[model samples]
Target chain A: MAVWLRSLRYAAILLAFTTSAYAESDPIGYVKTHAGAAFVDAGGETLEAFPGLALREGDVIRTGDDGRLGLTLLDNTVMSVGPNAELVVEEYLFRPGEGELGLGVRLLRGTMQFISGVIAKLRPEAVKVRTTTGTIGVRGTRFLVKVED
Target chain B: MAQRSGMHGGNLLLAALVAGLAVSACAPKSWVVLLPNEDGSTGRIIVSGPEGQAEVAEAGTAASLDTAVPETFDVSRGEIDTTFGDALQAQPSPPAVFRLYFELGGTQLTPESAALLQDVLNEVGARPGADLSIVGHTDTAGAAADNEALGLERAHFVRDRIIAAGLKLDRISTESHGEGNLLVPTADDVSEPRNRRVEIVVR
Candidate 1:
């Protein structure tokens, strides 16, 4: 009887997994370099950010006054977020071979360093970074930005 | 007259707060910088603020987007901005490539490949903090989908062999080129021995 009940519970778990809401989000990047106190706010759960931690869309990276974080995306684009900053990753898609490419991020406030990857290099106008003031368009090179109140 | 003076003082305080916020808006720090990548490819950065917009085109350049008029400075010349100095030092060296061929439609390596691992071992031993990139390719004899899987399988085989040979690298990326990028160009559905191979790029 216990075995049968355990089998039923396993089937229920399988059903819940297969029928869960389909979300097309994967780890778009990883925290390649981390220092001091940085946190990832995902679904309102603030987890301590570390190197190699996978990052996804709808995630916000909040850095303490002494924290700094570096990331490398799938397209090899690298980013460095400075101290006392809040950076949000809205969307990311990079499939250069099939030509489906995009990169979108919002910097609420703080300092950021961006190095263009394959998507921005291939399609000169596909990447967009938005701050509270305005939107930035990439033209295939490196740049830095800081948002202040 | 005294009550009126108090009202005026309150208004003055509110105005001072607003002025303080505005002053902080454009207060420029030292700078934010983007250094050159090791791979020789360049990246451009665009800054759009309330007052104006500016873009930077060169590597080793910096922008302090203070007051919306983004100013570019040559940070790499004399005194580096202490914030980005570490990132500049972390730039990768140019990649060094090693190739190993495989037999047709299988993971089995040719007899010559036995000596090829020694070369990879030597390179890994020499470089202290090098990253490895393994890319597998296949001939055009099979379906494109199947060839993709086969290519990855072959690359994984090589990756595992490298790991087993005792190179404890933390970052190793594996990819499959399938029937693309032929060393010797061939027609459709052709079997080229050289195409069935894996290329290892140590950087």
Candidate 2:
């Protein structure tokens, strides 16, 4: 009986841990500019995207055929995602002087505009954008990338 | 004469300066790592291209990646123009800007601007963590100094309202352009209603 009770308690704790991780993650970016039918997916919940709405890691942003979004990360990198685009903030870290700096994004489909910010300026290798085909590394400046489905 | 000796000393100083500059110029170029801040982003771009990987930084600098058989490359900012122009142009938009007009020499807002307050406040509240630049302006009326002071007062008044509307104080900055930058440029001390205003540019 004790063994069974302990296993049940373990399962309860695991459930609680997963629930909090998905629900209360800190935001990593925000919707600076958006139009049309853009939406943000926090874990599994999808909500319409609006300007100034907070974004977080593992969060996926999808824009309808009539939608577009401009997101500025905490590190100041500006990304403009085009219509019918899906972008994911896979990982981001922006503590400059302390050397904790990274920005990893996945452009799942459609097009993405990248303007490298402080994270890549401080350390070039720390910032990387991945598409199904290959990766985009920033030395600095702005660039555009499109992914074919 | 003392004049001749002074000229000799000056020539020696000039030579030393030239030597110093030459020595510094011959020194090997070094990479600069920019720290993150409120204004600009870093200048590094690295891409894995077919002819090995390439990296560039800054607009007018030179960087050598490999020492063996070294070749310097222009450090112009990197940009790739794939076929995303049409896609981006379909939805190009700028950040929202709010303009508020004020009465001459007073912090009181005009009737039209008073109505705009709700929308301004709502916009600020909606854009959480956005940085704002609040600029105050005045008609060419009154002494230049007083107009500047009045403009400043008006800007401060607007700033306080935005902060009271739940915007972070640190994110908003107030500036008084005074009567110098009039919307309707006029003769000095002219009371132009169009010139008196405060602008809240939210970024």
Candidate 3:
């Protein structure tokens, strides 16, 4: 009876793992540069940001007092954030062959630098960056934004 | 009574001047600034707020985000460095793209592209935590479905070579555009060497 219960527990664990894997989406980007204390809040877990950390569509990237982070997306879009920053990737869809392209990000606080990528080049109106007070429409360019407390 | 009223008006003007001076002493707390591209061309951005919209088309120009109306101003270099030093320092290296051409109807790369493979490997080695996207395209010489398969085959051929060079397979994504996305547009059944190519984007 003891061996049978152990086997049943193993099966249950395997099933949970497979189900979670199936539900998760592919990473949209990766953190390429990091300094000090940065964190990524993804899928209800807070992960310490590292150079190779995979970033998902709904991830919220935050930086502490001395933290800084840089990331590059599949569409070649580059974004960087400075200390005390909270930025969320609200939406991202980059299926060019199927005529689907969109990139949206919201900056809740702190500073950021954005460089437009292939998606912005292909469809300029599809990319947007929102702040609490205003929205920015990208036109295949590089820009910097700061949201104070 | 008239003299006292005039003095009161004078005090109000004096207060207004002081407030104006205070406002000009420091930059707006929340703002955005446009920058020139690497190619030295300035692009445009439209900032829309609850009150109104403002367009910034010149490099070094800024717009206030929390203002009643979009207020445009010029940001000096010193101010930019002071405000965005950390964010600018954290900017990642831009992505690089390489085009490798293939021979007609096969996965074999042309002589020039074969020679260029070394550069691609070197690029992959230089960056830390690098990832790659390889997209294959085919000339319009066959059925769309067949071309799609051929494109995938060509992409796989390149991916295999990269993996053989010791890079992990998980970091690379391969896709095929078939003849649908042609570098050099042509009539159906027309063959173009440029269209029979693969684009490798290293990021």
Candidate 4:
């Protein structure tokens, strides 16, 4: 009975590991540009931001005082952040065939430029950029925003 | 009494200066500005805050984010560059999309589309850290389920060619829109050549 229980525990652990790994492998975007000290916190792992870094939902992008970073989503949305910035892609859903589209981001501090993409064009109401003090509703366009400390 | 009145006037001036400084300090620190699209078209944005809401439709206009009531104001180019130069400079190249049409009811590309394959490969090679999305779409002929599978097959064909040209398989995604999303809307069982195409977006 003891050996069986141990085997069961091992199986459970293996299943959990595979599930999490699969989730992490599914990327929604890729980092295309970076300079200075940039990082991406993905699935509890802090990775140095570099070109071709895959980005997943719930990822937090941070830049040091001199850092800058740019990335493009699968839906073709482009975003870049200036120094001393913290941004998070809180939500993203771009399955167009089933009529699902949403892009939500939160800027904790600093500056960012956002260019809308297919998701914004398909469903303008579903796209939003939020700061601590305000929320922006994008209507298929490019814009710049800054949040001061 | 005149001397005392003069002192009072001086105090009033000092008080006014203090008030002005306070107002300046309390000015909005967080804001958003609209920019014209690459195609020269300006779109709109609605900024909502705890206090009120404001809409900015015109390019080069801005709205304060932390103010009691959102207000629109003109933003000069100098201010924009000074504030957003780094962010703008870091922006990646915009995504490019190409459509390749297929022969009737098959995964084989038409002669013209086959000639365009080299251009597609060249585009993929030009970008650093590039990723692609290839969605296959089909005309509204045959059953929807069969069309969906055919679309997948068509997408796979393009994906294979791209991978053979040196791009990593993980960097590409394939999907089938089937007849559900027709480029040229038509009745069921219609054979629309324009709809039988695969769209590849290189980002």
Runs in model 3 lying further than 4 Å from the true structure: A1-23, B1-26
Residue-level lDDT tens digits of model 2 in A1-149: 69999999999999888867876765676676677888999866798887667788888989898888877665567787777889998998875535798889888887666767668778877888776645557766655555655
Q: Name every residue pair that clashes in candidate 2.
A: A121-B42, A138-B45, A138-B46, A139-B44, A139-B45, A139-B46, A140-B44, A140-B45
lDDT of 1 by residue, A1-149 (tens): 69999999999998766634322355666665667778888754687876556677778988887787777666667777778878887878877668888888888877776667778878867788787656678877665666777
DockQ of each: 0.35, 0.14, 0.79, 0.77
What is the fnat score of candidate 4?
0.83
True contacts kept of 2: 0.22
Higher-lDDT candidate of 1 and 2: 1
Question: For model 2, how does the per-residue alpha-carbon lDDT over B13-96 read when each residue is reduced to its tens digit?
Answer: 565565445434432232211212123543554544223544545533332222222233322111111134333443322335
Q: Write the per-residue lDDT of candidate 4 for residues B33-103, one digit (tens) a residue.
A: 99988888999999998889999999989899988678777765555665787898889989988999998
Residue-level lDDT of model 3, residues A1-149, one tens digit each, is: 69999999999998888757734788899898989999999877788998768888889999999999999999999999999999999999998868999999999999999999989999999999999999999999999999996
lDDT of 3 by residue, B1-203 (tens): 00112235556566556544544765578999998887889999999999899999999899999887889988765456657879988998899999999999999999999999888988888877888999899999999999999999999999999888877787899999999899988999988999999999989
Q: Relative to the unseen true structure, what is the C-alpha lDDT of residue B54 in candidate 2, on a scale of 0 to 100?
A: 46
Q: Cα deviation of B99 in candidate 3 (Å)?
A: 0.4
Docking class of 1: acceptable
lDDT of each: 0.70, 0.66, 0.89, 0.89
Best by DockQ: 3
